[model samples]
Target: MPTAHEVFNTRFVKAMNERNYDEYEALLTDDYVGEYPQSGEVIRGAKNARAIVEHYPGGLPQDNIDTRSTRIAATDARWVRTPTFTFVRAEGTGNVGVSAVRARYPDGSAWWVVNFYELRDGRLARSTTFFAPAFEAPDWRKPFVEQREAPAER
Candidate 1:
């Protein structure tokens, strides 16, 4: 059996990837809350699950197949393809995890996401997640700092 953290992470990824709505909903707590900072939206309880199921083009009904992004989890800088997520646990027995997700969209676009989860009784009680895009450093800073190879190149 996987650890609670492992179970929570995989179940989340699998449920969503498979579009198993009921199974996905079962992973969350009754009073679950989800915050989407980028969209300035907050969904509470079942609404959160509903929103996840309803929103995201990834979940739209299409050919019966796993169309979600291909995920690659890593602790170091290099990105390695894998289904298992890497999450840090918070202090205490309560299940709290901070995950760093790197996924490639169906169209090949990619993003890095951070999700903060708080669990109650082995179910997700609250979570805040945000997707991050890579941006070029400002030209103004080039003069102020010495030029060096970017992390991606190393």
Candidate 2:
């Protein structure tokens, strides 16, 4: 069985993907808070959920991941979107879930973000989001690093 946080994170992303504003707001607490440390912005209340839809008018890109570890899950998002996704860390408890959503825009802009959720009494009380910009590894570190297997190989 999936943890409560996993359920929440998955459903929340689903709502965003589907543009189900009502369903999205339903998952939030009355005083829900969403923080974006990278943007230095903190959004509060259920209304902001709708605001998110407005921001992503074209909807989030489709992405999915596969895990070889039997202990973890193989989130084949083919059920959600084509060409699936990859995850770094995706695990959750009743109150927290690390949602694995990473994709590049059709325009070639990509973003990686980790969403940290804090649920209170079965509702999302607070969420702190951190976004990272993917940068090409500097050539100066070539001697100290090893290449990772391609996603398909892994």
Candidate 3:
């Protein structure tokens, strides 16, 4: 049998990428809670979370470039890439897990999402996520640190 983290990486992430919200929801506990400290947003329950992703960018089913762009650039950066979402890392033991992903929007902007998740009854019970945009290192840090290339986006 695969470990919980293994299932999370291969199954949970696959559900998200496939946009199979139902399957994703199945992996979460009924009372699942999710928090985004940067945005001060709290998502309580699996259904609500599923709804958000189902209608991302524009809440309604309409062609709203302005809304989409604003939503994409919420992390405040101009990233260069076509819409892409990939798993960066995911590791966990027992009931705790840490997962990270790089999500690129249609507006050519990309951001990283790091999720600290807790599982209960073999399902996701809580998730606290932090979002950050990629940025070039400042010249001031060059003297004190050894520079290295950033990890390639998977």
Model 1 residue runs over 4 Å out of place are 58-93, 134-154
Provide the overall lDDT of each model, using Cα atoms, as 2-decimal numbers.
Answer: 0.63, 0.60, 0.72
lDDT of 3 by residue, 33-60 (tens): 9999999999999998888777665222
Score candidate 3 by lDDT.
0.72
Clash pairs for candidate 2: 64-84, 64-85, 65-85
Error of 2 at 108 (Å): 2.7
Instruction: For candidate 1, write residues 30-136 as lDDT tens digits.
Output: 78999999999888896567666656543344454344554434444443332222232333245777766554443345456678888888888888988765456
- Candidate 1, run of 10 with poorest lDDT: 82-91
The prediction achieving the highest lDDT against the true structure is 3
**Runs in model 3 with CA error above 4 Å?**
1-3, 58-83, 152-154
> TM-scores for all candidates?
0.63, 0.66, 0.75
Mark the 10 consecutive residues where model 2 has the least summed lDDT: 65-74
How far residue 102's Cα lies from its native spot in candidate 1, in Å, is: 2.1
* Number of clashing pairs per prediction, in order: 0, 3, 0
Clashes of 3: 0
